[model samples]
Target: MAQREVIVGSRVGLHARPAALFVKTVSAQPVKMTIRKGDGAPVDARSILRVLALGAKHGDTVVLEADGEGAEEALDAVATVVAEDHDDPA
Candidate 1:
């Protein structure tokens, strides 16, 4: 398994649109991914509900983990997304 910690940059955190976008990105990967806040149990990264349930606010640090084929790439992609400020105008 590969894991990385990232600080969320979205103003609204991992909720609504931000969570949806993160889920969509992770769902496209072949590897299994999970995310957790602090010492909490990791939850499926591809599930918007699960990601949102983490209540990760802006500036909060979260851990992203993935395993299986392309796990490192998957983790890197998701971590980049999670660290981005999705709430900002594109």
Candidate 2:
């Protein structure tokens, strides 16, 4: 298993569009993943509702953990998504 902690940098936090994008990214991974915030129980990273339910506001630190063959990569992708504010400037 691999785990990483990242802070939500988006001004609006992970709401609506960003939340959807985050779920999509995490769910796309083959590994099992979970996200936890502020000592809260971890939630499946693949579930949008569960992620949002964590109430991870802007600047809040979140812990991401994954297990399986591609766990590290999966966590990295999630970190990228959150760190980039789910924005792709392409």
Residue-level lDDT tens digits of model 1 in 1-90: 789999998899988888998999999999888899989999988778788889999999999988788999988888888888867675
Provide the TM-score for each candidate, comma-separated.
Answer: 0.93, 0.90
Query: All predictions: root-mean-square deviation over Cα?
Result: 1.2, 2.2
Clashing pairs in 2: none
- Model 1 scores worst on lDDT over the 10 consecutive residues at 81-90
lDDT of 2 by residue, 36-85 (tens): 99788988888988988887888999999988898898899889888766
* Whole-model lDDT per candidate: 0.89, 0.85
Weakest lDDT window of 10 consecutive positions for candidate 2 = 81-90
Prediction-by-prediction clash tally:
0, 0
